[model samples]
Target: MFRDWFKKDEKNNSRDIPDGLWIKCPQCSQIIYSKDWNENYKVCIKCGYHDQLTAWERIDLLIDYGTFKEIYKNVAPVDILGFTDTKPYTQRLKEAQEATGLKDSILAGQGEVNGIPIYIMVMDFRFIGGSMGSVVGEKVVRVVERAIVDKFPVVSVIASGGARMQEGLFSLYQMAKTSAAIGRLSKAKIPYINILTHPSTAGVLASFGSLGDVIIAEPGALIGFTGPRVIEQTIKQKLPEGFQKSEFLLEHGMIDMVVERKKLKSVLYSILNHLWRKVW
Candidate 1:
């Protein structure tokens, strides 16, 4: 009891100090200072915890300094059946825009990684779970087409909850559109690297998420068509521990490797470097 009292006293006294800042490390559960962590790009020094990054942050971290150029291709919305629930579809679009600060879910552009020019696309989950709708499909197809035309490789970082539910059958067509574009890229022998982020599911998984020439996943990310709970309810059986996790997918031959966040740039650089050595 005396020891517990002393510990509590120490904790209270420590809080009195002003040279303290709190940041959570996802790997080792350490509380660090903001200055220290921001200097280290939010990676935990103790256990290399990779903090969740926004899509824009990922592009910033991946690309060479001052080498990203945005490619804007405005795609009009296709409103079939006048889909609406609870509020008008336009109102939902407005809310999503205000919340995510994005005109759309996917961002595509040209960026240089270590002086090597490449095409890149990333899905912003904050925009309706990064659901692949008509605009997303158009964006992806345009990027892939541009990549093929320019003889550049495409690296797609995806975190999607599958096809957009609001668009119905129109959403499903994107799967075919993207798959066809990827096929064209393959026929041209251009490499496509799919970096699967958290919660990649359903139509997204069925398409480009799994079609990379080299597929990589973050540690412990959940990547599968159906989530564990949904499968459990449908199968009426409990899943084995850690099923459908990145490691499980690696073991099951779905992913090539599980790359840590800090090392992600290095690993991708090596692959692109090796491939470009032969081409450029």
Candidate 2:
């Protein structure tokens, strides 16, 4: 039994270990192999770390038939202040368009999961890290209004850093405006499903990110006003483990549920099924 264990199996340790395809797990900060990360919804194998997902990928997985009617597609931003910072804001917008093949940060549409109709708003983090500006806020309000008019539930997938700084205080106003719109939707008695994705922070969180009837967050997503490091510095103390995380927030009684990416659709379907039973 002891003889075979000590034998040289291969020259594995003789040479340098080559760099494997790596992607940062948004949860654990572990750079893991791309193939494994992708296979596990970008979750880290070592620590069950969940990574951030793009709007396109998220919508494709959550919606049935991959057939959602897009709304508010042409609501482009207007440069009222002639804003510039080495590159013009409009030019930056063009660059983002070319990079993401999306008109703007937000994607609004009507889609169904298992024939249960719902209006969705997915924010693409690729487009300026999904910052919520006036236009993004306006588009979200339009979708909320549409959901109200259609008498359907609203499901918003949020992944944003904060208010769009390029627009200055104008972007900050979206927080209040969007919150008011959600308040109106709430008054309509239509359910709002807020699926908070990774890296959600700042102004967006201050408003609708926490306003869902049943709030759900992807595991390992960062949800907070100020980041952990910033908070630690301000408080002059080291933060606790897993601060601002979905699980941490859940423990502190902030969120309703912490769901994985793969199970999101089924969970949503189940919730909706139970809700719509009394209606129809």
Candidate 3:
């Protein structure tokens, strides 16, 4: 009986040690309590570095509790090109789907932000680097169309390495398709806000990503067509400091505002409320 009691005490003592109690911040390399990091919106308290959020996490952050209703959840990507490199495209798609619990990189839904009804589409970088393929393009166009029909405002959060190269020309075609959809939104005079996150680039940046009525970017986000390394290699010249970053883009008139992660919701709420008097 004493032996059994000692074993039970040992088990209880072992359980007392917390699992994943501390996390290392990628930016500052600061050891922070996991709970504290999460409570601060995943920003490093020491260096103020904002970590990327997954599509669902971002949706929860911006959308009111129990208000987000996802639209076009059934839309899945197609293997039109049957392309393969080191691995089969089908295998890649399946793996990404299972890992992210997402059918594609982009998620479109309607939600209330601070009690204001709005339509939002958010792209996640974890899925194939958040590349926009035919399905992503189609979903974005649909979001704009729904906004037009409902006369509601639209917001698109872009975080992509650009068009999905696996789809070849089919992926390139999405640039034009989404651009045309945004054109319609413009004609309708519906407010379309684009929120550019880390590394918005390539065909996505050239298309609907930049066609926003107001373009806003997160602090330290990279926004440009071609990457700085590629540009430097092609030009055989060194690039300026902080090139294509959100602050640099703001100075160059490429984007409207650069907002910190914590203030994003309030800024968005203010903008949406300003656009629609009934949003309050």
Candidate 4:
């Protein structure tokens, strides 16, 4: 009986498990069960490295259950420039849309956080690197305008690679447009908080991403205008370790705080509560 039981255990150990049941942590290289990783908000258990989240996942993480009402769902990107690279801009948009199930890279809406009403915008890096185009800029402007009218605070979670190059000048123009809208929000004295995520860079970083009254970044997030490699090549000097990371930026006085992914909702709620109380 003992011999039979040992053989059965060996057979079970040799059985093939389906793919995606395990995840490899990029930072620590430790294999983790997918269930545990998801339960931890996709953060690495061994090293605490934060993985990128889809816009909907982020919304579910931050917004109170059943309280998120998406706006501007109909606003889709247009190939105004008739732009084409290796592939046509339209085709790329279609593929990204099909893959991510989003009209654009951004998801903007009104949601309640811990029973506090707020307007929130989240960018999904999966969609064309979360590049900002005309629709994204328009949605951002509209969301902030709505917040101004509703007298509610605004929160933006930025995960971007910068302006959409296919749109050419139209993409770059969003920087100005979004900055001006945030200016209006600032003038209104309403609280605007920005949560910078991994790969928050380029045009997005230069504009409204940096205009938040309180800017927060996730641990280990890449936050910068230009990438470190490009800067090093241009300057012909090696960059410092951890350059432009969330922790580095915080140490350099660039951002307000570096919060863990698991604590983001609570931190946001606490900050919003304090800031909202001052507004009233």
**TM-scores, each model vs. reference:** 0.85, 0.86, 0.92, 0.95
Model 2 residue-pair collision total:
0
Clash count list over all predictions: 0, 0, 0, 0
State model 1's lDDT.
Answer: 0.84
Candidate 4 per-residue lDDT over residues 188-252, each given as its tens digit: 99899999999899999999889999999999999999999999999999999999999999999
Deviation (Å) of 264 in candidate 2? 0.9
Maximum-TM-score candidate:
4
Report the number of the highest-lDDT candidate: 4
| Model 1: CA > 4 A from native | 1-32, 35-51, 76-80
Order of candidate numbers by TM-score, starting with the best: 4, 3, 2, 1
Per-residue accuracy of model 1 over 1-280 as CA lDDT, tens digit each: 7687656566557755465467877668888888898777777878765565667888887998789987863554656748798876677777887897777788888998888889999888888888888888888889888988899989999889999878889899999999998999888888889998777789988997789989999877789998899999999999989999899999989999999877788899888888777655
How far is each candidate from the true structure, as Cα RMSD in Å?
4.7, 5.4, 4.3, 2.7
Clashing pairs in 1: none
lDDT of each: 0.84, 0.85, 0.91, 0.96
Error of 3 at 182 (Å): 0.6
Any runs in candidate 2 off by more than 4 Å, and if so which? 1-39, 278-280
Q: What TM-score would candidate 3 get against the native?
A: 0.92
- Judged by lDDT relative to the true structure, which candidate is superior, 2 or 3? 3
